[model samples]
Target: MSAFSDVELLHDFLTEAGDLLEDVDSKLVELEQSPEDAELLATVFRGFHTIKGGAGFLEATHLVELCHKTENLFDKLRSKKLLLDAEMMDSIMAATGEVHRMFGEMRNGHQPGAAPVELLDALDAAIEGRTVAAAAVVEQVAIQTASEQAHSPVVAEDDLDWAGLYEAVVGVAPRELEQAALSTGMATEAISRQAAAAVRPKAPASKAKAAGPATTTAKENSIRVDTVRFDQILNLSGEIGLTKNRLSCLFQSINAGVVNDDLIKSLDTVVGQLDMLVSDLQSAVMKARMQPVGRVFQKYSRLARDVSRQLGKDVELVIEGAETEVDKSILEELNDPLIHLVRNAVDHGIETIEDRIACGKNPKGIVNLSARQTGDHIVIEIQDDGRGMRPEIIREKAVEKGLISSEEAGQLSVQESLQLIFLPGFSTKDQISDISGRGVGMDVVKTNIQRLNGRIEIQSEPGHGSKITILLPLTLAILPVLMLKLEEQIYSLPLSSVREIIPIEEDRVQFVSGKPTMVVRGEVIPLLDLATLIGRESNPGPKVGVLAVSGDRACILAVDSLVGQDEVMIKPLEGIKPKGVAGATLSGEGLLVLVLELRELIEGKL
Candidate 1:
């Protein structure tokens, strides 16, 4: 009767229907590849059937009607009564997209209406193997809706008195009025049952009959908790870890002054146990936030197929390591970046069938997506076995866009030239289209990845293929930092950005192009002193250098000394961020260690 009472029902429907839509979407893409897969057809049919039933209960009028028609089409295809063709599949996919939109509206507290007349007409025609040659409908209209529950009973035929039934449904009427609905045709079963129940007299049941056992299964034991609650738990665990650190400090200090051997031994033992328990609790909380990356990866399968078809190319996307677990927040942020990369491969990286054939390669191009866990970081790679990028073309485009001069472009190495794509408004294409070529997406992709404290590297040959690698930290809440010491002040940098450490010798260092450089593995790496970057006056020495690798550049950071590494729980600053600090961490000795964002620091230096 009221929207307030339907909150739980709507939430349940959304949760179940959200999963069903994903299943149907992924299966619809597979069905396109193998149209004759009987099992896929049946599974997709059942997916829509179950969603429709739930929608009916919630009175999601548009969703129910849309799923109803799609279910019919799939049933026909499953039974071999109708054929699955390109046009038919397109119609079904379009309806699925509409259902997704309606769900969004419903989530925002807006009641969704019916599917468009054009779409409904197209689905109706599709079930009968007919085609609607009209363009896909862009606008939607609302149709009157009724909930399966809270609706008047339906008469099957014209055998009942219509006026009496209408009065009974919408107004208070006498018991005799309901009796008039009982005499009707077979189509009037619903109204007849309602009439009989309304006018019947109840009799008391026997004690033996009343003792019949109820039949019902207990629901599975579980409750859904918000992710924010888990985050609070993680924060508490970090506080506990800090307390353990303090206890450890106290335990060691008390032993030296006080000559209580038994007291020292008990404190040491209790501190050790608390340390272990705190570590375990922190790890458990981290795992609670971990979600399989496959949830985000699944949506890309359909994207690759659709974009490849639109480009008039034959490309197949092969996904690996779908079970790799990453932070749930990371997965959400990764969705759009991965999409841009996948589309770029389909549109710009992959060659058409004829072009691929001319190159003596297979007609279908292959796009590979793989993920792996390396220590405390997640690595995801997107590779395409098609014509790779040309450094020369990128150089010329850079020159044309005024991003670099002719002399500067000529001086760039092949690897350096490829890095120009990350510059805003850099594109080699002569025309613009819906997908790309307007110099928009690549720079944003790099920016978003970097915002996640991730680095992206591109490796491509002239004609072989191209691979894009994305390296991200395990969780955003905690960072594994390589602590570096500069006299009395300590600094922290993400270990993910630290490629290696090298000893900087004055004799071995030389100036190549008005910049200090050092040779490492035959590659010239830029060298920087930490004191010079931060305007700190210190005596230089032959100290160890941190080879900070961000994006495609490697810079050797000279520091006073190397401090041992540790996992630091970072506390984010609210406002007015410092010059080079991303956040600050408190060490066991009550010292504040400033965490450096290596990418930002390096960029500011250059």
Candidate 2:
């Protein structure tokens, strides 16, 4: 049997190899800085060596070849034989990337193919460059070709002549196979194979079932399941939530006192116990899916280093609160957004080395990325102590992009001006660099955060520095929400964003620039009727207001009444999800209530 047919072994190899690749990639970046760190060099070498062994066992020959070359190079570096250089580090990083790609290919059930000879040759050249500075070879064997070959020979994604070809290949004589099909020139005629297949009796469905997806039926099956059983817990928890709908119907039927007090007490006790059990299960499952954000943060360390080097600037990435844990799903979705933010920090937020020195700032620019659990949300801040954003330049760019009129742009508050950065098609750089100048990233970051029920806040000063704060929910699947009523229609607001529920006073209301404004604790905040925001008729009677804040901005949402608070399982809508509505959940009353996307609702109005 093929090594990959041993599903258990293959999964083990994939998991271990993936981790090794990440570790080696990070160590390679560190080794670039301290070329002589023998300890780090040894760690990286072993990481590659172990992966090579596993790949070899899996018959992933191409991956083995690439890792073997990297391991050998690291071995030489560790022994003080071949010294590490920028060019050499680049080659190693590229080789590691190829190894990662190979793992992905294997994961998708594709046979691993050879790396481009150019890449293998580049690895050889980088190792050789210690003595000869193999510039010619490195140029000849470019990583560009490797990337091209990685996904080369794009063919029609359809099966062609599978049955006939399978029979032709299998029908070859044993003697001919001994001589090799190539030497024997055993090319089967297409017409003859088709005729033979036509003449052959059709196999029953049982035989076809036995054939399945692979060439052989001897392969055993195994699966890689999450240790936390998050899916299982979530599925069962969703079923438990249906009890709300049932109870709502039951209460409606029992409104006439047909149900006795004893029965009510019994139902209440059972439900209360079930709720506690479900909550415990949820916590346990969430804990299982909870991985330290450091796993994602660690990747950016190498990314920031590489980006800063490419930009020819001296910058250090400081990571904090990496041990803070979040849902695995959140971590995966957060990766791209974080990458864009970090790259911008390296390319745009930081000043050039010479400029920093001239300004009497430290030659080394600092981009600090940090995450911490604040209440129900995880706050991630990417702050840089480099060139800060100037509101004047932002206003000019906003006007140029037709995002705002010149006069309107001029009137924008500092906070509002900083927000222009998150508008699509707004970029400050005069010249577009390969890294960031397309002006497409920040807006996407904001959109993604909001998709995850999160918020992004940008703060910058003319000369001090710039800070982008992202506030994200602990998880996207479930949330604790305060269910509210707007004229008999139910709605839910994220409990974390709700600061306080207060009564709306007729006299305290005033006009601020023609918008409704109210004072709370001597601070005036813009107020909007929640009903009007969601396209319902405004309620004129005395109303309750929910004070909600997104980052530094605060607003009051006027609602008809507060129904109470509950934990909700928010199911995403299918198509054309309406604005200001993230998803829907069931109120205990058996009615589907829209979960208010606080960011969209407040931002659109205020």
Candidate 3:
């Protein structure tokens, strides 16, 4: 196969494997509830079987063997030879995790190491009713089988045609070849004889069968088209849009001058139809770049389980809206941030059994990881019923780290104090653990989220759990922003950050210690002049555009004017970072504008 074909095959495998892995995690959770579920057991077994088979074809031996052992264990359970219990479920889930890790390694061009020899040994012991080291693989595979009086015929090991079975099991030949062999009633030796007899003549038939399924499947679902092709399509759509605009302009000019009634009406109708077609095509192409959030959520199950076990805590992760779709590029960048957040929740956010007992809380803490669509944004929340943030302690830590002055810390609201945890080199952990609290993780999480032009907010109560919400655009490639003007230059602010645009009367604003303060709805809100913040030495405009910022603390941004709202394509500001710019966007009229980073702007004022 050509290089293109190889890449296409890999892409298909990745996409399918990703989905299966997601389903496996979800099913594992379901099995926890209904440990004796026959259908869930079968579904998980088949999923592992398919993965093992595919891994074999891809020459991923470690993955194949690991999954093979897992499949065997499930097979035993399904046949009513074992019992479903917590220990057994944990071991099986751990093995599933190993498979997931191996797949990741293979994707990154590395050879995966074998599953812990002890793990496999424990599995064997579980099958044979023996014990190993400290951990014993539980026997959890009992299922209801068909009644013995109506026993189904069982083919003896030796009675079966071993050679044909081997070929089919190993997938040495294409699926069609195996199907054709079954259909023709030809033994392995008979197929070999037929191949030798015709030599050249039979070659085409064999090749046809070998390549037929691959080709047809590739045409239907396997082909990995180049991203550049999508770019080219986008360009064409843009050109078509521009053409329609230009034609409309011409029609308007013609109508004003000559008023050719029939031609003008015909042109208008044609332009309308063309516009709709172009719009539909653009939407379709954009949809191709979207993938379900389940791809990101699935890996967390294994992480949550492992971390909980390691910490000797009983924690359950509940996920919702796994089918929520976001752009593929955004999904790719979301992995690390999501992992960090989930790990933090399990490690630091959720309390252990003893601690929970002391606090009079549930022994098993629950961590809810959910996603939902809000307007054009996808809000992903990680909420836990663990010991929540102590704002006073966070403030003290921030002061110790020299992140904030004592005076500044005193003025910080509980929410503002919680946000300080995300500051660089700041950690609330009393001691560093392998899981978290080294202070290096959350800063990276914040930066990565910001790089995607998303915002992160933290909400917590002293005794209640903490909730971290990450609001991201549906697609980072294009964003809806509110464009504004400062110093006669255009700028954009993400609509997610702009809670509302309100005009503040000059008299309503007062200066407190040379800082602007406005009382909106009986609450004193600090206002920062955008022009002054960006180092633009200009007089303040009559009207102040107040942008409501989202974070631990809320602030109002006073800008000169609200230019307008626009659907702008966000372009990253490379090299020299603009002092107060979060991103750059092109206006509908094709002009570049700097997007203000409200968080940074507010921070600077402090």
Q: Candidate 3, which segments miss by more than 4 Å at Cα? A: 1-5, 84-91, 110-113, 134-262, 265-291, 325-333, 358-360, 400-402, 405-407, 448-454, 461-464, 482-491, 495-563, 572-606
* Residues 561-584, model 3: lDDT tens digits: 778787765554321223345555
Better of 1 and 2 by TM-score: 1
Which digits, one per residue and each the tens of the lDDT, describe model 1 over residues 5-76?
A: 487777777777877787787888788889989999999999999988887777677788888999999888
- Model 2, 63-174: lDDT tens per residue? 8888898888888889998888777876776677677668768877776788767668878876775343333333322123222222111111111232332234335432
Q: CA lDDT of each candidate?
A: 0.73, 0.72, 0.68
Ranking by TM-score: 1, 2, 3
- Worst lDDT run of 10 residues, candidate 1, spans 141-150
What's the TM for model 2?
0.70
Candidate 3 TM-score versus the reference = 0.66
What lDDT is obtained when candidate 3 is compared to the true structure? 0.68
Best-to-worst order by lDDT is 1, 2, 3
* lDDT of the structure predicted as candidate 2: 0.72
How many residue pairs collide in each prediction?
2, 0, 5
In candidate 2, stretches whose alpha carbon ends up further than 4 angstroms from where it belongs are 5-12, 129-279, 461-464, 486-489, 497-562, 573-580, 589-591, 598-606
| Top TM-score prediction, candidate number | 1
